[model samples]
Target: MGQQEKVATSLAGAVSERVSASLTPVDEELERRYPGDPGTRQPVHTVYVPGEQFAADTIRSWGDRALAALDEHAPDAASFAAVLGLADDLAEPVYTRVRAKLEREPIEDLRVDFEDGYGGRTDADEDTHAARAARLIAETYAHGAAGNTAPYLGIRMKCMEAAVRDRGIRTLDVFLSGLMEAGGLPDGLVLTLPKVTYPQQVTAMVRLLEEFERARGLAPGRIGFEIQIETSQSILAADGTATVARMIDAAEGRATGLHYGTFDYSACLGVSAAYQASDHPAADHAKAIMQVAAAGTGVRVSDGSTNVLPVGPTAKVHDAWRLHYGLTRRALARAYYQGWDMHPGHIPTRYAAVFAFYREGFEQAAARLAAYANRTTGDIADEPATAKALAGYLLRGLDCGALDTAEVTRLTGLTLAGLQTYAGPRRGDLTPSAK
Candidate 1:
């Protein structure tokens, strides 16, 4: 095993050693650990990695380096698969397996992209006009030529501030319409309205899409997508904080996801120099709020990109640093554990992030809770007895450094209520997350 792979495996195995050693079935001792109804626990988690997460960038880059190294020893490079595959019968390596699977066959839904706005302009000079026209043609074709089955795509409106100040156009209505057509906002398209200082901005944009969808002969329900929650106003007044909910209500079903407008939101927070949403303290808190607001409802929440943009090759020292620092590793990973892959590259991390977080720690705790509720083995499940057992399991897991509540919910379906009553973590509540 490589040094990095060895580190990850040894750490994970060491953390899960006790559970692995005690594959012991639920018995009297187990019942005492968790007095709960049996057979009630469900496989509550579903994979939530963004297909095109920056993590994908990380994985792909890592794969490139891995393939380069492996090809030296083994020929048939294209068919060789991942580095872990090189080690036959050498299973139980999560990092290598996770990295390989993500790099080779990236999941579908995890991919999300923001469409750049048009830079069209009127110019008297022949050369200038030609340059603008070329850009327009290139972008128009680019959108069309790109692969379909979009993980998710959001189109930003061209600079309305410039349109208003320089060209004296106020509403951006005509410009937006033209840009939409140029970008091919056909049926089932999700449009993102940026720089929205007020709810009305979003509502008006929502109306445009509704009208456009109808004009295009697209079924109304065949549409209804989402937008990014980026602007300073939107971030400050998240969900319950402002007219954001009203804007969402206006969107009808067209609004399905909300992304933290990291850079812009951070600027609003008065950070001296602008930084990407993932880096700022405000971004973290805002993301939590947005996440909570979208929770339970079907609306998905996404964290903004690392805007530091992967420089150099993947698996490089810088990429590792980005993973460690620039990324909200624990929070984002926790969300992944709960089945929300907010970024594309994050999808691969989703598997490990989730399994490592839950595995025996979350799952076992939940299973023990379920076993406690079962009276078939003759012990009754009462508030007093069950709470003690549940508390005992939680304290032990917490002491051992395990704190995933969503898994607890899966085990008992009673976690939320318990959380509300006891003020304990629910649904992987490392801290009050999901705005």
Candidate 2:
């Protein structure tokens, strides 16, 4: 006590204050621009149906069809495991969770596509279909039909190109107006701006949404959109800069995600139809760019869909299923965490691969995160960043029904809130206890 009391501080408080004053703006900028993940539940896959083809029973029909595909081809856990090369220990749990997910929530996010999926149509016809889609979606949400509506639902309008700008805007206006008139927008409403080629397009979208909000008396920035990276120009500008990053900035905090467009992006790179898949080098390059651009911007990245459909004979279906399963698993491992399902038949394999990935890594991730939270020594010396990742992994597994609450709690001795604290920001504030 005598020695400690005799010490005098050499660093002055005024110096610390001056340093902080110099860095205050940068601190605020970082906090405002990159607040990290929103800690919301992200869907596993988004299922797209043509605007005209979407109906109230669309979700239910997809679930039934997926279940039928499983029954006819896989038939049991062992067969399904064999087809996807799932581990023996994971076969039963993964298969059971896949079946349950399909039955309970076949489609987490649903996009009624008016872009390529709907093709060209007269302006009046497109407008009518847009209104109809909006009305059906609103009605489903209003009626509280859990099985009929996806957790997130929206439409994908045409690109803002010279030829289709007016049409796309009109469709968007009609659909949004229809929702406004139909008891207001649902909580899970999402929108996608497809084929964005420039940062100005994202800016244009923000202005459009602002105008819509003003016209409807809604709060500013209430509507957020996913930017579809369909064109190469969206990735790299004429000046050779990363246009996608600029697009996110141009969004003004309204960008929810960056969704890769498989065929369009691949074709832009001159990839042949046979090779224009999610795992193609071209596709990977674009998505990787998108991933980097969206890294800390509160915007997510989603992989694109495969054109291959799980149809025809059992052998053909099995082959398609295997391909889809493998691609989904690969995307999951890469941390894309979401993809697009073009067909109802893709649902079975989508959930199967997702469940397998989460369950396979569950125990290890939980243990490591638990150890980090408790400040205990482990095989791997995990830092704060890794603890955050591990927490996120388990949270995703829990969110998508791959990991049961009881099991997660039992394994980690942490509740959902505790896990969220580790997953969320403020890692420096974490103590050596499972708070």
Candidate 3:
């Protein structure tokens, strides 16, 4: 075999050797809360979902009333927009108040997303606008434009049927790739694959992109894709996510994340359209799939948007939903490692949720990962005895910084001379609890 193939094989062996058989289980409380099966090891990355409508006024942009229903309201009501983090390009009046109220918000971990082409009309040509968005995002993000925190681009398509359309659904392939290639796409683009149904649709996507990368000479898989679990197929417990999960699993190294389409998932089920999906049974079922997907796989999963309900001017309504958002944010924070937002107000909540969720727990997870990464040349261990687990560990460690030579020496109890017995030094991080 050539050198690269040899290197890969060597890595596989080293990781296979190091992980321990007997270890403490992760917290059950966390397991119940997150549905991660205590095995999914994907390194967490937080992102802010964009609001459906950015009100011209800043008041509307910050926090709006929730779609959560009261005895009086209809069940099909739209939710208040929980703005995770608003765009820096605030409307003058709205900006002043929102900035005054929420300035210097502790927001480093959150990624603020910009809406690309909302109304059916593309601000630039549909293709051109997408490209422009890619360019602008990279530029602005690099310069620390969105108040120093990175700004991402979310391409919310102009609905399935819109004017000045994409013509056919198949054209999404061209549209997305064009956008990513328009400028070098950033790590921040959440290519929200909305309204996904069949496994073939996803598989076809992976195949098409593989072909596109070859033709364009773009390095393989630089652009990561996220699937929005929206349709009835995703919401119904009986309908089953097994096919979709298999699709994501088949993606292997390609999919970056899975986001639950809260409103869409709600609508798909007979859940009242008026409210959000936080406590709904359908959303819970969807979250279960998310937990399973992330359990042993390295792919990250996210909860979906709290469709921009108006957190109105009334102190009673505003504070009530704000508190509700706070509670829901924490619930999602605990349930999954991540979630979505509609208004900019939601960013602080998301960020806080992240800090609360991981500040303490992540250190332990990081510590455990370090322990795994440091094992010696003879440290053969097995859970399921699969190649994927070993492969996963290497990738996870690489992302989370738990693997290095020193840790290897400590875990293996091997000296430099002893290391020579192995063909070469070990490398790569292991994945999700060595499953």
Candidate 4:
């Protein structure tokens, strides 16, 4: 201490004070706009069911049907592993975890699709279905039975297009009003505003949600929604600017996510139906822009779905399963983290790919994070930012049933709080010698 204290800086303390004062507002602005990850457990995928078909047993039915598919086609861990081409070392663990996840929490998040999936019904029919969907969701959450309800539940209403704008608002109002009457909205409640093309569309959604909160006596900004980026104009505007960035700002701090609409978006670019896919170059370009725009805004970006359903003969189903798995795995590697599931049959391969992704990287990520936190020399010698990424990877693994808490603690020598600290904004403040 004596030797360190003996050294003196050439600049005066007043200079630093002046610089800090000059940057105070800038610092605050940065913090407000970019708060980093929310440090919550994000769902691995979103399952969309047509509004009219939603029921009390929807989640369980999906799980059961997926399990039945597994039973009839793959039948066992080795067989399932072979179908997906899982590596030898990861086969048994991934298969077992996928089956368990399907048996347990088959749907992480569920959305009642009142848009394309529901198509155009009479106003009365739509109204009836919307209320029914809300009632069913409320009942599911009210039961509070483990594995009985998806953690997050909501409805994806029609777009803000001039033709459907009022209908979308009316449906959202009915759905939220139903939830309020049931027992207040669940903490895990989610909403999606689909086919958003312009910044004003997002602003209109915010105002609608604000009006709903006032009408229902819920807290201001209590209701948030995903912005469905289904059009090229949503990504890039006529003025030649990144329109999605403005869309996020237009959300007024209420946008929860940016969900890619695979088919709609592909169609907007005039891709033939046969050529449309989540992995298409257009999809990648759009999602890549989306990823960058949402990097630190706490707004999640979800990849779109594969329309190919894993059904029919075993061979045909296997082909579809492979495609889904490959797309999911690819999306994960690109850091999309969440996506859409169109069919019950897609559930098994979804979990399989998600589980295998985390499990395969578990050991390396755990070691790297542990080394960073403990200040140990390692092969990677990761910096603070890299450490944050490693910690996030491990946390996502833990959140989605991919990694066990006890095992993670044992491997990393850190508690959940410690890992969260590493994954969060204050990570840079952690010194090399600090745990």
Q: lDDT for every model?
A: 0.41, 0.88, 0.44, 0.88
Model 1 segments beyond 4 Å from truth? 1-93, 107-191, 237-241, 274-279, 308-328, 333-355, 358-362, 365-435
Q: Write the per-residue lDDT of candidate 4 for residues 296-345, one digit (tens) a residue.
A: 99899999999999889999999999999999999999999999999999
In model 2, the runs with Cα more than 4 Å from the true position are 1-8, 425-435
- Judged by lDDT against the true structure, how good is candidate 3? 0.44
Ranking by lDDT: 4, 2, 3, 1
Off by over 4 Å in 3: 1-117, 122-125, 146-183, 235-241, 250-252, 308-310, 314-334, 357-435
Clash count list over all predictions: 38, 0, 39, 0
lDDT for residue 236 in candidate 3, whole number 0-100: 35
Q: What's each prediction's TM-score?
A: 0.49, 0.95, 0.55, 0.95
lDDT of 3 by residue, 257-337 (tens): 777767777876778876655657677777786667565444566766565443454444445445535645455444554
- Give one digit per residue, the lDDT tens place, for model 2 in 143-197: 8464566778999998889889999999999999999999898878999999999
Residue 91, model 4: lDDT of 87
What TM-score does candidate 3 reach? 0.55
